[model samples]
Target: MKKTLLVFGLLLAVNYMFSQGCSDAGICSINHGFQSEDKSFKSTLELAAIYSLGEADVGYFSPYISYTKRFSERFSFTSKVTYSTAHGSFGTRSQFGDAFLIGNYTFKEKNKKQWSTLLGFKFPFTASNLKINGYSLPLDYQSSLGTIDLFLGTNLHYKYWDFNGALQLPIVNLNNNSYFKEYGGTNDFPSTNLFERKPDALLRATYSLKTPNKKFTFKPNVLFIYHLGKDSFENIFGQRENIKGSDGLTINGNIITSYSLTKQSSLELSLATPFVVRDSRPDGLTRSFVLGLQYQYSF
Candidate 1:
């Protein structure tokens, strides 16, 4: 167990340096660079639900679902959907939904992980409606912005630790034009341009410790995110002007524990905290606390 813990700790250190070094150039943000890989031609499902409570904000809820299936030892595909809604005393109530698809590939043999790559495409079908102080908005405000995304990513895993990252680029940005014209309600609204570079990169690293029974494991992870681009979140309802050009850094750490219930079943729990945040929007919402639970079954 001590050896496992040491290994994971080293991985975490490496991830931290990798993320920080990106600012020097020729390096990528950690969020989109490093991620774990599961190489089974099997199906994995995830269901996430979250609720936030605060001052006048009252509360907000989000429910997300994803399904992933591997076609071969090193090839896989995934699909996901998310629904979110919020109500506030500021006389604001809104709801939004999105759907996406992704594909993944591994270059190494098994989990050796010299290099693993993932390429994906996402088609977003978004529908949203908002009301402030009990007043109706324009029709375009309640419609969908048809758009697509292209993503490329890689992961490097050593004996005791691993690094994962990815980059997401927009391929079809029709949604931006539609949103600006509809939400901005002005002919001078910004135009959708694909040549712009957006900050959609991520990186993460984790180390693991095994218990004497081998059935129990503990893992600590660190994560970072960078949002780049001029109009990245523009047109998105509720987004503040400060969030634009608001490129900075955020760091989060999580500790996860897993206990084996049986050869085919296991229970997992995680606790996390946002340890660092830079240039965070003053009005932006930050995660205060997170709790995770998962059950696994194999056939």
Candidate 2:
């Protein structure tokens, strides 16, 4: 009975993590480019939790918050913060935090079909004290590379359809060299020369239909992502190897329904699924199903 209860609890936690943002490869990207009219401030909050079943039991939970303000008809600014936790059956756990700043500019005139461009930077600040499968990994082992991301994207909005696309470039990387040397089992510590670069590109499109009363709407969206570059690993004993691979691509789709509760409040539910995956890295997991709920308020 005790074992059964523990299993049930773990399942619940995994489910929560899945909802929060567990990709099959353990990477999470939060998309929040949906926009609003000018001269308005919008805020949104979301939460997701997940669990991994089978021989290897793992669970994760993540919570995120975002705020955006439109300064003029053609410009806007956004800020976001997120926290995440991960746990494994062997009693290992890890946590991380991320923040982002974004600026958007419109190239077309107001009330006309136009294109908007977005530029952004992401800062990953992480601290973890967790064992990996009972092995005492250093606190820095679980940290991200602390990268600076350069974003360039354009959004096209028409009466019934919308399209968005972006490319992500990593301009700077800051990681503890000793951590990679120890874990990767090489003596290449303190040499930043062995570092590599990775980049990503994304494209998304959506179609929407509004109800007669204009209080409810249905939207279907499709997203495509491609990953490029190489990751290097070295051992404390001075052995080194570079993992080189071609770009990987994935396609996903989502259906979302939104209902207006009042003039300034709305509720939204979204269901998403992975449609196509190609050239997946052996060590990475692909995203499966995703469900999300969001609440937005304007003041």
Candidate 3:
């Protein structure tokens, strides 16, 4: 019985690791480190292919380009642009994704431990005016929610491990062109989604490994996110509708592999999958696989 208990405990620990990942669904970058690659200039090009089955069916491909520049050892800036092509059973569409920018500052370092903070903003670029057969497409079919978001986070690095946490608040999310009418056909005219979103929080931990040849590195991580509840929406019929069941928790396990082809160039691949979930998740994710390939160059 003691042996069986020990095995069960080990399994539990593995399950929890996947839940602590630092990345989220909206993130497009593949660089998951605590600092800016410890260099002065870095350029990254990444392509992500995501297949989401089950309740939400989608095939999405997004390309991300990022440039991180360092002025000194203590501070760096990163700017990334993204575009996506997506297809579903209903139809196909392509659009530019949200713009992502972040400034990183490292502070509080002593005894092989370092702390870094990230302050960033995402600009609104996606348009939500999508309709098929004269009816509004479901929210899942829209490529982006068109929100300007602000982000703040910090990372703690100790040896070969990193603990990262972040919060994202959507300050402005508005798309007045199309409206999703209430189900069951209420007595109100269709109105756009005018509700403000709650803050989304994430926590992740990553452990890095280097190959004996010093040409490759492996990183495995766990991520967890808590999506807070949404606000109420005012309808065209002078009524307020409270959207519920939209708050929940999710956990994912991700692995990233990198190979250095040369001193200035490298390639990376990443995979993420969710394993556990809880609470009322209206329009929640059932299961998904995000596969990514990234090429990096530094000079």
Which candidate leads in lDDT? 3
Q: Which stretches in model 3 have alpha-carbon errors above 4 Å?
A: 1-33, 40-55, 132-135, 177-192, 231-238, 278-287
How high a TM-score does candidate 2 get? 0.71
Write one digit per residue (lDDT tens) for candidate 1, span 54-76: 22233446566666676777676
lDDT of 3: 0.62
lDDT of 3 by residue, 73-143 (tens): 78777777777666666567677766778888888679999999888888867555566666655444455
lDDT of each: 0.50, 0.54, 0.62
Q: lDDT of candidate 1?
A: 0.50
Which model, 1 or 3, shows the larger lDDT? 3
TM-score of 3: 0.79
| Distance from true location, Cα of 34 in model 2, Å | 5.1
The sequence of per-residue lDDT tens digits that candidate 2 reaches over residues 224-249 is: 87776555545545666555442466
> Could you tell me which 10 consecutive residues in candidate 1 have the lowest summed lDDT?
20-29
Error of 3 at 200 (Å): 0.4
On the 0 to 100 scale, the lDDT of residue 125 in model 2 is: 71
